[model samples]
Target chain A: MIQFRPIYVICLREFKKFFREKSRLLGTLARPVLWLFVVGNGMNSLIRPQVGFSYLQFIFPGMIGMTILFSSIFSSISIVWDREFGFMKEMLVAPISRVSIVIGKAISGTFISVAQAVIIMVLIPFLGIHLTVLQFIEVVLVSILVSFCITSLGILIAARLTSFDGFNIIMNFLVMPMLFLSGAMYPVTSLPTALRYLTHVNPLTYGIDAFKHVLLRNSAPPLGPEFPLAVDLLVVTILAFIMIILAALSFRQKE
Target chain B: MSIISVNNLTKKFKTLTAVDGVSFSVNEGEVFGFLGPNGAGKTTTINILCTLHLPTGGEASIAGYDCVKRPDEVRSSIGLIFQDTTLDTGLTAYENLKFHAYLYNLDRKLTEKRIDEMLSVVELTNRKHDLIKNFSGGMKRRLEIARGLLHYPRVLFLDEPTLGLDPQTRNTIWDFITTLRKQEKITVFMTTHYMEEAENCDRIAIMDHGKIIALDTPENLKRLVHGDTIHLVTEDNEKACAEIAKTFDILCHAENGGLFIETEKGEEFIPRLIHSLSIQVKSVNLRKPTLNDVFLKLTGRTIRDDVLSDDKEVTREFVRSHRRAQR
Candidate 1:
């Protein structure tokens, strides 16, 4: 019962708004620059290249993960806005299936997140990291998968949230934990058993690990991909599927 | 023929029943209204018919499709303007309408034509390019009406369409609604607690406590209460009530610091009562019975009493400000 036209229009509306609010694009882009230059450099001086990679190069994939994670999750905040402004009823009363709305939002969030991830790749030359054209393409593909996975999780959370009050809770409890435990800033192998279990559960762990597979191919064993590339993609794809189904089911509530 | 049919429809929210065995029908090309005070289940009934809520009992249908069994068909056959504005304030008016057209899956070639036609119907073509946040309340309402009709639905459901607008804007919206009924050949099923607004309907169903107390044409409902209503204020309302009952044999009820009585030939009766009563009469007002009087007569209390309480007024103001802050 899912219709293509509704999904297309929904995504198109999001795309139009994304460009209209120029501040949003600027704001999402600003975080990566600050992290890459300010934090990465300060950490670079403090931590030596004990594993054959500078701190700046080691956290490069983590920076991309940061960009995608923030952009994708914040994009789903539109659902809360729509509900507050009463526009969500318009879609609910329409002749389209709820699945279409969920997919439309997920697709829009993924594209926007991936766009920012690509923009982050501009730092590769500055970081003195070499990337083949195929490697760059593989990185973009992983970004898309990771973005969709995080955005779907966001949709599932937003589906039940009635206002922005829950947004702060999500930021503190969900987004921050997912980033810190995902091995984006540090290696998961060095973590103790308790936090390492959380890293395994976080989807971004597999995503950033996939990035390390391509970007850090020549790095020492401790700094390279934590799991096989196939395992990373498989986990992300499965999580994305489950999150989207749960989000759509939440929208189907008869309230 | 009837386009909307409901039979013994009921909806319960845990312990309280919001819609209790309500039944009504709306004919094609007719303006049918549900009039009642707040918490009277008018909104709950509309939500069920719009396929937004499931009825706990009985059945309802729009355009031959069951609301519960075939919600997609019911949704496709009807357009809804909710009690609150649903426009995306970030987008232009034209973009909002375009979003609606896409949601309804209108024909690609006809979409532009329909959007333009609906905009002009609401006289919003000039403001189509403006962002909705910049538009006034009345403008936002007109755009919502336009977007609702872009899909060419068989029936249009409006839940308290003119709730917060000023009198002038309310009138203008009503003009567009009536004109669209003819121009689009569409059925209108609207709910309102405004008795004055109920006059605009071809048929009005007075609801209270989740039940339809009375259903008929406005004129016929008014006819249910015989004669004009006379409001008299005197030095002693208690004495006036007794005097009027003893002398004129018409029982007068003291309400809102006045004595209200129902009698034929109110103009002549007012003068005779003033002369006959020993008490001094400060003022005497007489007017024809309105939908309010009809409701008062049927329900034993005025709808105004339920709707015009002090707490309700404060809550309404708070809600209005809250909505403004949200925008």
Candidate 2:
């Protein structure tokens, strides 16, 4: 049977590490705040009327996705750091199954990612986005799911990397494209047929779509064709599951 | 019973055979040391027994659990202190121990007690709350040792536990380990390239080129050295060398303007040589057999020479710079 104590201990340590580093905490929040105010407002005049909502409001969910995506993926960089510093040997030599380490990392990343997203969620009122308590709860639930999926993806990538430099190069290359394709900065409906097809394939697209669906429920008419909430949740859940298994498999390889 | 047993265990990484059909068993409560220079498969053997790497051939078991087949049981039974410092520098010393306790499935009260006891054993109780990043190398090593023992495994594997420490710090660490052996009766299986360090082990297996070149107690291994070495700087090397060879019936070589001889009871032979030799000897130095002598006898080279030949320039440079910085 899988033990719960190790997983709990690992998750608690990660949480402690994340909070103890004041600079890292600020860094996680800074990017999203910049995008929300500077990028969102800068483009507001040009894209607001076309999307039927203020650009800041339109991009809020995408900002949440961005926060979750960057923070979660960057958190996996710790695994590479651990390996370099010999701390990975301590964890690997432990009696607990490798799966526990992966699960613990995924859970911790999800927690931190959610925590960062909450920082964005607090600015919901300033963005003029209206949401009832139920809608807020729905957004949180979707945020947790997206965080898990992205964190698992991070773990999978990190398991195969031996150096932080390599992880940074690969993660940056992948993360920017992933964020852009996910329709976080723009509406998927306005994309050309080719880019729309790409968005359909991007898993983060579903995450942002799910968030937009819930956060914008009481706003003006739906900005895009409403992909059923059930479909979005199913896709994310499946992606998270697959990424977790892949992460575990990659971790199982001989060190 | 042997706490660790291996039957022709071999580990090959692709084309290179790291451990070439090595076999040995470490009995319970015994301090068994694996001594070798770099690239001699000492770490490979330790890794296989620790279940970190699977052997390509043969079999091994730790505390009656097969290392490959029942890795979890083996891992649970063995505590590993890696050559490199593995403590999480971001965490406090207490937090590091707590994490290990939880991993080993220790209960709340037991975990607390063990953490406290281990911290005290390593004499880090006062600094338990301090982050490891602020710790010195010796302090981090002590914390790692405390963390390793918190689980209280049946066997403790220390891979070059004192690799980079100073002589004083290394002695303190060894004191803690020897004390632990007597107090807890845990078998210690360690690897080191330091000949003096290996002298502390109950028995040692000397490895070279991925093979066991010799295995015996330090005293017994020293006995394997044919005789004591004598270096004599005489008034005339040619005459002294000829007289010593004829008089002692032992071969002597003129090296670096000195006569070198290997003879039994070199001290006794020294007086006779002085009495018989016509020319006066300037200086006579008689040295007893050391582990380096034993290694030389077996491999025709010293461990340092072998280490220098190994192409681990990065590690060599790191150790050099680290030592220089420390000085």
lDDT of 1 by residue, B1-327 (tens): 999999999987655677789988889999999998877888879888988777789999999999998998999999999998999998999899999988988998899998888888888888879999899999888889898889889999999999999999999999999888878889999999888899999999999878999999999999998999999999999988888888878888778899889989888887788899899889889989999999888887788798866754554454333333322
Q: Provide the TM-score for each candidate, comma-separated.
A: 0.95, 0.92
Q: What is the C-alpha RMSD of each candidate to the true structure, in Å?
A: 3.0, 4.4
lDDT of 2 by residue, B264-306 (tens): 9888888887899999779989989889878877876678876
- Global lDDT of each candidate: 0.88, 0.85
lDDT of 2 at B200: 98
Alpha carbon deviation, residue A153, candidate 2 (Å): 0.9
Question: Fnat for model 1?
Answer: 0.78
| Over 4 Å off, model 1 | B310-327
Best by DockQ: 1
Q: Could you report the DockQ of all the candidates, in the order they appear?
A: 0.54, 0.44
lDDT of 1 at B71: 92
Residue ranges of candidate 2 with Cα displaced over 4 Å: A48-52, A189-194, A218-226, B232-247, B252-260, B268-284, B310-327
Per-residue lDDT over A75-133 for candidate 1, one digit per residue giving the tens place of the 0 to 100 score: 98889989888898899899999899999999999999999999999989999788889
